[model samples]
Target: MAAYSVADGAEVARQVATLPDGGSSDSLCAGAWLSAAGERQAFNDDFTLLAGTVPGPGNKGKTATAFSVSGGSPVSTGPGATASDDRAPVFQSGTSTLWYVTGDRHLTSRDLKQPSAAPADHGTAPGQSFLLAGDRPWVRAPLEVTPDQAAVAPGGTVAVGSNLLWRRTDPAASFAEQNVEPAVLGPSLNGRAPVPGSEAMPACAARLWFDDLSLLCNARNTLLRVTFAPDHSRVDKVETLIPEEQGLIPGAVLSPDGRSLAFLREWAGTVDLYRLDLSAGAAPVRIASLAAGAPTGSGGVGRDVRVIAWQ
Candidate 1:
């Protein structure tokens, strides 16, 4: 059966027997991958930063060496390491040193400063590694509202990129805050910006981020730049404009690093994916053509595009 009921108070219904670590299925050091959201979480190999694809193929009948992202760079964690299409990252609190992974069956964390050797089994299970060295989950809250985008901020704060909202767990109180006060860096948040009198969109899925004194946001179809005070007390929106339609998604995020972006565009009745090179300041570069169908009036009737980082 695809679905089955478990015993009362039990999470697992049936356990699939794990195969032994040899026969064409296991790779040495197989369970290490990383991620971050809205922030440039660098992927390091043996304490060295990885740019694009790194190495290692698992003993399993799979080319473990190939780690491709819809947008960013990736590094391999060895055998039994979980592969992920969604790679959102966050750093450990009280330290700017190590980074952690957010989305996956098991929440994973690693020290950026630690050499990229197969992480030791510091976790409670046999293969699981220590995510964040703490007594509890890194993010402990009352299952509050899901964030559209999140970034690890200074002073151990996870900054929700959209809505300019902030939330943190007060260790003394031992609970997560639901309604975090707003830093209010842009008008696009919550669609509070004045209605545009021009031919523009109503701004959906705004991407808000903080960097140094710069608070950046991408709204409607344009990127808005801003600045913040040292105290996180004052914020100002500077300017906004649409980026060139290169290899960038119109509504989804390509690369938060702003170095490169990937987008799905419709052409000849099919949705094709492309990558925009922000460094070139021109139209997007074509990475690969997505499958498309019959052509409509001018272009193919393709579905919208979606892109995500990988771990």
Candidate 2:
């Protein structure tokens, strides 16, 4: 894999590592993120750096690893370091604490400072979740009492579900279900409806904007910006950044400044990366083509590329 600068799209660094299932020949079951200081933390089903001799056993599952952008030897947290699940391991951001779901479906956390120690069990894992940043940091998992997927704003207000926006300011508070009015499409696309028989998409892959007043989500094969009322009582607006006609967006990440979004889209057997400025009426600009081969996995819709992080 290679690291490129978002500013000029210049390749800055490249690391050759051997991934499980015959390197890149199989589905890339891996994820990575960069720290503010430019260090990369990543995980793979089984991985080995170019300098390493043996790859981790696939049966042991995903292994957590670390690398430096400046170039150096990579480090692995070792076998049994993480759960065998496909979900990417999430860091607390700016801390040594990491969070992941166990094979038994338990949400667990452990500190890198104590790598060999047992992880602290949090509870049953949610259907979907992400880190909620604040003075009191916590994992924004699905509500135990409800089936809806949830995303927590920086101020502690939670937005639940997709067909409708449900608001609950506190964990102990009751949710106020609110309807999300149809998106205000452009004149040429007015009155258009979702493809027939498509299931309602959830906001599980949403990123809380830096401002915290809105969420940038890739759902329904489109990019949307869901804005909330200042009081956090209801959703004030829902805007489509990129329409579904574009293609299947496997993943997206917000820029550090929250002014742009980078995502991976697969269309016509080709996967390409695109960046969009959040400005009004701005169009997406193609950055790179990730892959051009016969689609893999079921239904021939599996994505070969994924956006891990924007920073």
RMSD of each: 15.0, 8.9
TM-score of each: 0.39, 0.57
Worst 10 residues of 2 by lDDT: 31-40
lDDT of prediction 1 = 0.34
Please report the candidate that would top TM-score against the real structure. 2
How many residue pairs of model 1 clash at the backbone? Answer: 25
lDDT of each: 0.34, 0.47
Candidate 2 has what TM-score?
A: 0.57
For every model shown, the clashing-pair count is 25, 0
Question: Evaluated with lDDT, which candidate comes out highest?
Answer: 2
Local accuracy of candidate 1 as per-residue lDDT tens digits, 1-311: 00111112122222222222321211111211111232222222221232122222342222222122222234344444443321223233333233322223234445435435443232322111222212222343112222224443434444534434444545223223333544333344444332222113223233434354444444433454444455445544354434534332333333646555454455445555455554534565555454532123322243322232311
